[model samples]
Target: MDNDIKNFFKEIRKLDDNIDIPAFEEINIKRNSPRKEYYALVGIAASFLIVFSLFFTDEKVQTETNDTDYVITLSDENTTNTESLILEESSIYSWEAPSESLINNFND
Candidate 1:
C-alpha cells in the first residue's frame, strides 16, 4: 500500500509539472436598498383600518314586551263535583313481561 501511494503521487507530480493554471477574477455587483418606510406605512395603515372598524361598528339589541294576562281556573259552572272523574285501581292495567312469540319476531 505504501509503494502504490508513492507511485500515484509520482505520476501526479509528473503530469502537473507542465500545466499552467489561471488566477480567479473578482466580481463587482451593486445591491438594492431596503424599503423600510413603505413597510412601516403599510403596517400603520393596517392598524389604522382595524382601529377604525372597531370604533365605527354598531351592535343593536332587540327587546320584546308581553302585556297580556293569563287566567287559570280549576272549578267552572259545569264542573261541580270532582269525585266522579276519579280513576279506579282495577281500571288501570299493570305492566307484564313480553311473551315468547313477541320475542321471537325480533330475531328474524
Candidate 2:
C-alpha cells in the first residue's frame, strides 16, 4: 500500500510539471443600445397597460355592482320571466271525476 501511494504521488507530480495551462480569452459580447432602450420602453408600456386595464375593469365592474337596485330588478325580472315561460308552455290533462254509479258497478 505504501509503495502504491508513493508511485501515485510521483506520477501526479510528473504530470503536473508536464501539463501547460491555456491563456485566458475575453468573449466580445455586445448589445445594441437602441435595442436595449426599446426593450425597456416596451416593458414599461406593458406594465402601464396591465395596470390601466386592471383599473378600467375594476371601474366597470364597480359601476355594474354599485347599483343594488339593478341586481334586485334583474333577479325579479328573471323570476317573473321564468314563471311566465312555465305558464305559457304548461299543459293540462283533464278527466271527468268518477260518478257514484261507476263505484257501484265495481262492487257488484
Best by TM-score: 2
lDDT of 2: 0.78
lDDT of each: 0.67, 0.78
Q: Can you write out model 2's per-residue Cα lDDT over 1-108, one digit (the tens) per residue?
A: 699999999999999987776644434555579989999999999999999999999999998788754543353554554434454433445544569679889899
Model 1 misplacement above 4 A: 1-34, 58-108
Candidate 1 lDDT (Cα, whole model)?
0.67
Candidate 2: stretches off by over 4 Å: 1-32, 69-108
Candidate 2 — worst ten consecutive residues by lDDT sum? 81-90
Candidate 1 residue-wise lDDT, 1-108, digit = tens: 699999999999999988976544333454444577778788999999998776655221111122233446666768676676666654335745559678878797
Specify the poorest-scoring 10-residue window by lDDT in model 1.
Answer: 58-67
Residue 18 in model 2: lDDT = 73
